[model samples]
Target chain A: MAGLLLSPTEKVFILHGVQDDYRSDGRSNIDYRPMELETDVVSHASGSARLRLANTDILVGVKTEIDVPKPDKPDCGKLEFFVDCSANATPEFEGRGGEQLANSISNMMQKAYHSSQAFNLKQLCIFEGKQCWKLYIDILILECGGNLCDAVSLAVKAALFNTRIPFVKAALMDGGNIDLQLSDDPYDSKLLDVGSAPLLVTLCKIGDKCVVDPSAEEENCSVISLIVGLTGDRKYYYPKDADKQQSVESKCTTIGMNGPGSVAPKTLKDAINQGIVAAKSLDEALGQALLKERQQNIGIKKHSYGFLK
Target chain B: MPGPDLLSSQGLRLDGRRPNELRRIRCKLGVFTQPDGSAYLEQGNTKVLAAVYGPHQASKSKSTTEGVVVNCQYSMATFSTGERKNRPRGDRKSQEMSLHLRQALTAAIKTELYPRSQIDIYVEVLQADGGAYCAGVNAASLALIDAGIPLRAYACACSASMAWRNGEPEPLLDVGHVEEAAGGVVLTVASLPNTGSIALLEMSHRLHMDYFKVVLSRAMQGCRDIEIILDKAVRDHLAEGWTKQDVVTI
Candidate 1:
């Protein structure tokens, strides 16, 4: 942020490029920067991933702990997101400089993942209203390229997919106290079903068009952008013999067009449509990549090239 | 020491390293295109990335007519260790590290060459196992070279821990987290290995004055070895002509 400065003419040039469906880096409007993702990079975390999206580098580690379920949501668990923007990215981000950006990103992610349709908290529950698993998703921003939301969400999704929760053996007492035992073998764990987890996609509205995954230059050119959080298929669960009836379309499975931006109704509509298409394709590609990585892990053919290696 | 069990009867320390062996160092220069200079270094499990910017106009109050202002900042990742840290910088420990880094780097940099300018060197520890300070120094040195900064020498840092073996004091080079946590006296030295002059030296815990010479010399030797490895890496990086920017400049 400190060293990356663009002249007025350069900003205009980038804006014009976005309007013409081309980016400064020769990428299309919806094209993402070349990215590399690796999972299980940190041995200490329950789940870990490192993602490099162009110059932006992000690492996410998910730790699991036991806690009592909330009385209102007795059957569900809890999730907390913390983002640490390290000074390594830039000297300007030293001290508490990046705190505002980090807070904003973390807040946006929390809102995106708030709805039950985005994640199934029931899977994290260990006992009904007694004990539950709480997930601490810690995100470390190593470097800031541009479009931090998109990159962080993608890394978080990949890390969540890579997370393994140890299976708990529990016994219930007459007083309703549950005793739990976790497996000693590290490999003996349960993988989360994060297929429906949402991934944030930022659409930077340049001259007259919107570009996905804008570079730093492109970001400096734009005035405002819309963040869209799109999820894959989500299955609704109900208790046995419940009187209520629900349908898939009734839940409104998508959340789009967020952030501080004002747009024409027509352009907003177009952006939403574009966002849905982009999210679907992105989700599919992410799924394929994650599945391939998981297969490689199973075959012992993958080596985690973390920062050290 | 636990009465000197750092080295076992089988002649192996924790993490399976000999008394004088250093951790494997893998490094890459010019990892990023944004910074004027960038380098990534990994010492065993600890990983550090350093980026250099400037020789440009100095910020207000920092400019001096005599020489360039060499500014440095050191930070660590929240999830870099077993326990998650709440904050990465602005802490007392990080401030001390920043000061230490500035002292060592200022000694190596030819500040008089660029008058009334500022150079910013930033080191970020992505993963911290042990010897993070040493890794930061080495990585920043590479970054300075990549940025074409004139330096007296390649500034190298290494830590030596003293433990009694066979009733004789032995200093372990490049101590890892396990060894460091064992609570032995650790002497960290940053120096110009060729000149054999110390840039910065810090000691934590206590050591007898009689044994200080041995421990300090051992740390200096480790720095010399690191310089050899880093020199080879720089040469290999340059030989490959992997720096595409050179083509544009040419």
Candidate 2:
């Protein structure tokens, strides 16, 4: 939005397009742009993913560290989100310029994943309040076209899905202190249950209608946008459970409105419902992509397509 | 350090490459549409992305008649290392890296042509296995070329480490994270290989003065090798970015 400038007539053009339920890019009001995702791209981190939604590029890496659980929530593990707005995205993001946007996105993700129904932190617990795995989810904003919140959340979830927490080979609790041994073998690890991970859907309000996946020009034309974080169903992430009667339903875990303009209660409700629908379809596609990637790594070594492809 | 050795009896490094073999360098130019030029490069497992903004009008305060001002920022992802980093940039180490990157890149760009202009180069390390600085320089070079910035030559950077194989000191090319952590001496060199001149040279962990030349030469050789690879990538990118045009000679 900083570099992109649209004239009054250009803004009107976008507004009319949104009102017609068709966008400048020929997408419907509820449709998202084509997205490309790949998991396990970074070798340094335990789990990593790169997601490119049109021109917005996001790379997320999940690093697991052993630490003592908090006294208040000893049974639960820690999930900390750190967002880095790289200058590669835009010059305005250079140095500490992007810190404000980065903090807002990270905080939104933190609030979204805070609910137990959204992400089960107990799976990261190692020795029942003594020690647990602390996942440091670091999201790097490499490029930004628009709709950064949605891209970051999707990449985070994919990285979490690819994350593997090593099993505790040995543990010893000594008066107020604990020592734990983790297996170094890469295979001696457990995959996280990220099926219920939250996905954020940003609906930009242009004119009186809402549009999903707004481009940079559309973003500048809109005065306000709502980011809805919805919980994904386990059956979507794990296809093995797809055969069973679907019991889990999509739920709104968090709702965040960004911008100076405000939304009416009626429009907000409709936007929330629209977000839920968009999230489900997005989740289904992401699940299929992750499953396909997992199957590809079954018998042979994965020739990583990191940035080469 | 005592038990795990950097080199085995077969003269192979820990990552299975020969002492003088550089890592597999795979690179692509113009990976993004936002920046004037952007590239993504992976040297072994260390991946880097670089974006070049402009040689446009310099800011009022920074404007000068001397030449183009080269501004560089080097940052690594928080999860790029074995341990999660607290911040991506602005740390002492990354700030030093930023200066070093500017030093290396400034030597290659033709600054005199763009008087009172500024070129901003931003390098982001997505995964730093080792020799992250070298990878950053190489990626930035590609991005600069993609941006169509005139340069003296291709700026390439590489690192070398001394590994003892069968009681002999063997200079290893493209040091990896494990070897760097093995208490070995690492010598990093950023050079314009075609110009046959060094732009920046840095060494960490003391090494014998007698073995310094061998390690330095290894790193320079690595730079030359990397330059060739980057040149090919640039050529490939140009061919891809071009679209067929019908001849119009009226």
Candidate 3:
């Protein structure tokens, strides 16, 4: 992390603002900065998305491969997360400098998606106890502006939503071998059911108060941050259709704490509650945006606005 | 032995491109604000983003009095290629690319003017459909220009491969991934088009001595065409921001 040099007075000012539930940028404690999101940005990827939350730019691409399922979990698919902290984000990340941070973020995502209720791996299964789809979720951190965990999770979920898996038929061959045939048509594919995918929310503990989506300056003011990953509701994902709505309770899939500071038991509990609320709202907004984009893409050629826009 | 059919019977390449035609290039400068300069470039399906930082004081171990040190790093996203990559950087291939990038960009930058300083250029490939090194060079050049670094000239790079069209030697410009993987000789050239000077030239695989010149010339021609497009983009970017400065001057 690049440290921001702040005088004691500026730190006190930020502390006082956080105590008042008002931030320097006129945002509430639970308010997140405006973000720009675009999907299907990378043509070579099965699914891809780019999200710019303030200045923290994250690009995620999902690539699908066919492989044998694990012996213990023969009926489920695999999801692997790889995070690359690009040197372009900062000179400090050059060479192997950003490996520690990248590994931490990837581990966080891996844990968040580990729960079956959060993401059903059965959807990726091609053949029982045999061939299955292995998705590689590659995350590229182009720029850093704080609140990276939240942004990365959001981008990953969006990328998964945009992913299209081709239909494959498996035939039982002699000696327990399976022959697979893939569809030739590009559009003849099924979209992943990402309605229950988890999203992360980071609550930075500033002066005994926590804030969501802290800016870079605010992040410097805080000594610790609690990250909570909560599963999303499908009802919010398809609001226009009542039949598709399911009243699934949002569950906590994973929780992580960063920085060296420690909090009291009561404060930690409150922060986790705050993070859950924030994640739910964030998930709703993301689901609505993705649904709208998909609606617009129907029967029309999608004009990809990648890095150009 | 003749290579795979890179050129169809109708004289079109596998991607429906003419032998001398370069892929469509869309580029934008100043794509990021944190770095001193940044640019994004898309050459066909290959996409690269480059960022440049500093002409600041160099670290003690790498300092030099004669000229500024140009440090380059080339990394590709794990999902950029058809096969998933375990590590994004520090690989032998990426390290070699970093050195080649430095070699090409050092030739264009006026390094002597900023003695004992270091300029860092980092390029990240988001999607690699082939000619990633060429796209990296082009993106880095635009990023250097955006950083207002003094340059001798715009350094552009393009790759060319020799193919046969009706038993006649035909040189292909801007080889794509499929073409490069076809086991043909790919000649990559980086040059300053305005100065008519070559910065870096590399060839993969072997070609006949008689046809090397033709392939190299075709790559050079592609560089010239790319230079024109880059120059126009720079001018357009300048025009967009000059309005505010013009009012202040008045």
Candidate 4:
């Protein structure tokens, strides 16, 4: 969404609309535009998901590897985030042109997934201090409409939810060596527990008001935006345990801001609260969609509609 | 001759395809609005996206008085292959692929028509199951057409491999990742099928001079077949009302 061209009159109109709590497209301040999500799209990766929010297209693939646990964090595995902005999105991103933007997004995502409350790294542990699973989450930006961080986070969460770790038996051999064996059965794997995976929500400040999921026009009008990453309730991901579900408050894992505009403390607090509400609703909807797809998969072969559809 | 068990006893190559058959090709043009032209193409398991920009004024250093400068880049997503890739581009293999793309596309483009100008073609591979270069070339060709750039002919690329059935040698068309890794001679060709001229030709591994003609011919035949599929796609795209803007060509 490189500098969209809009006359002064258009910007003012968008500003007035934001002040009135009604966007030009008739969306309220906290409403997000419709988005489509699909999982297990890439056959090569261990897990994959594609998210389309308006014109923004994000594809995330999760690949797993076996590695020795860190000397300090012997009980935890590793997680790495890499973001690639493809030239297909915009020619301006060609050949290292988009590196700066890519680095920022990946760094922010890394920070978001750092908190233990957001993602549990201990589940990836194989043999305590000996070995663990390292997950590589690669995000590819095919098209950019606006609000890239939100789309990428959602896509990555879905990809993680779709990821599977094969069952491995580790045996401690004589002296200090470890021998690992993987079962031959394809079903000998377990799905990753991603109930508390964080989702990012961007709040664009326009005309003294904050709005969620701003369009490119609104993005161009706003000088500042705040991105909040918050955790979702575990009950939604595991509906079978609804009777025993516990009520947990959503927690913020990371908060970031962009643009040169200054924010008042009061407005910043209010915007962060607004972002949390928006993220919870998004999480609920995503959980429902993913669960429904899982239900459908059990009855028959899941027909993958990749880019063709 | 085909090495290893690349060919089953029934004479069918790996992945259940005859030696002369190609993988299924599916393509769509104008997938993105930001670029001057864009296309998404999937040849069997391989998927690629291509975008085209310019015929705008060339950068000062790249401009030439005789013809337009053609620039190409080839990149793959880090998660596109079986093993995760650490970087997307700026590698030796990707650089060579970019050079090969520029060579094939430059031949079909009417570069002399736009003097002192430039055209940029960028290809991104979303999934790679072998023949990534050929898929990139095909996708870029469509992107060029979507941009409505004038061309001598559609520059199509395809790969062929040498396999043995019974006592005779067979040329496998549109080799997949399995057959490619089976250690056989793979001959890749990019050609202007309409003009019956080869734009670029590359081969890896060993092959007898006597069988070289057959392998080259098989790859060329594949290009011709791909040209037909691409032509039909362009026609369908036009019929679906992409002609709102006049495709004015010089």
Q: Which candidate is the best by lDDT?
A: 3
**Separate DockQ for every predicted complex:** 0.40, 0.58, 0.58, 0.52
lDDT of 3 at A151: 98
Q: Give lDDT tens digits, candidate 4, residues B13-100.
A: 7799888999999998887766788888999999998989888899899999999899999999999998889999999999999999
Write candidate 2's Cα lDDT for A1-309 as tens digits: 768767898888888988999788888898988889999888889999999998889999999888889999999999999999999989889899999999999999999999999999999888776878899999999888799999999999999999988887887878878777889899899999999999999999888788888888888988899999999988877877678847578888998888899889999988888888899999898988999889889978778887777
Q: What docking class should model 3 receive?
A: medium
Superposed by TM-score, candidate 3 places the C-alpha of residue B127 at a distance from the truth, in angstroms, of 0.7
B48-120 per-residue lDDT for model 1 (tens digits)? 8898988888987989989999988898877677787767777898899999999999999999998889999
Q: Clash number for model 1? A: 0
Ranking by lDDT: 3, 4, 2, 1
Report how far off residue A106 is in candidate 1 (Å): 0.8
Off by over 4 Å in 1: A1-25, A169-181, A233-261, A299-301, A307-309, B244-250
Give the range of the ten consecutive residues with the poorest summed lDDT in model 3 chain B: B241-250
Q: State candidate 4's DockQ.
A: 0.52
Q: Of the pair 3 and 4, which is ahead by lDDT?
A: 3
Local error of candidate 4 at residue A11 (angstroms)? 1.7
Q: Could you tell which candidate, 1 or 3, scores higher by TM-score?
A: 3
